[model samples]
Target: MENKTPIIALVDDDKVFQLTASRTIKAAQLTDKILQFENGEDALVFLKNHASDSETLPDYIFLDINMPYVDGWMFLEDYSLFKTKLSKPIEIYMVSSSIDPRDVDRARNNENVRQYIIKPVTREKFIELLGKAAA
Candidate 1:
């Protein structure tokens, strides 16, 4: 869906980080819808409704694990509920500053996840991931 164009979403509570990342994505000339959500619940709601009929369910989703309303794990669980519900695979990456081994393991083992990235994701890093996906 989404007119076959890439959709990039940033799910983070920090205003500074959100702004920085948004700017980075824009400056890179990736040129896509840079959607932002303060919490996982909000992102999940949009995903469940609008993206269900759409195909490009976030070509790249940067998800922050620590949030008040719904953490990243909770979001992942909520997202998993949509089994066979959509046409596109909403690729996800666990983006956070948490160093807890458990969180890393969980993200690594999750079937829907692509990778676990640290906070303040650099533009170069995201571009690298984008290259991987493109390749």
Candidate 2:
């Protein structure tokens, strides 16, 4: 029997965070492919390009609030407009190093956001998230 792995998308400008998160996900045996984008613009482009294909759409998205072009908030705004056209539902999680109460409140208030996580996502968190995703 072949095990199917989930596709995870990481939208962040921090190269170190991407690398660390990718490694952590792999180490946790959560996912094999971690599609990375340096900014929300690139991630949005990818999503738009694959909107019609459910097989190509990401199962999970880890979005950072800050970036050079098209921050997470902007992406969310645009995504709200584009989501209705998509073939599948994407589970989005707001991940950032920011500990600001405003950010947490904002993420919590967003209907599309599943959860808010701090940076350096741990293996345990990945396992928990993966379990939830499977459910």
Please give the CA lDDT of all the candidate structures. Answer: 0.83, 0.90
lDDT of 2 at 104: 96
Candidate 1 backbone collisions, by pair: 1-55, 1-56
TM-score of each candidate structure, all chains considered together: 0.90, 0.95
**Top lDDT: which candidate number?**
2
lDDT of 2 by residue, 1-135 (tens): 244688999999999999988999998878888899999999999999999997788989999998997999999999998998888889999999999999999999998899999987888898898788777
Candidate 1: stretches off by over 4 Å: 1-4
Error of 1 at 10 (Å): 0.7
Which candidate ranks first by TM-score, i.e. highest?
2
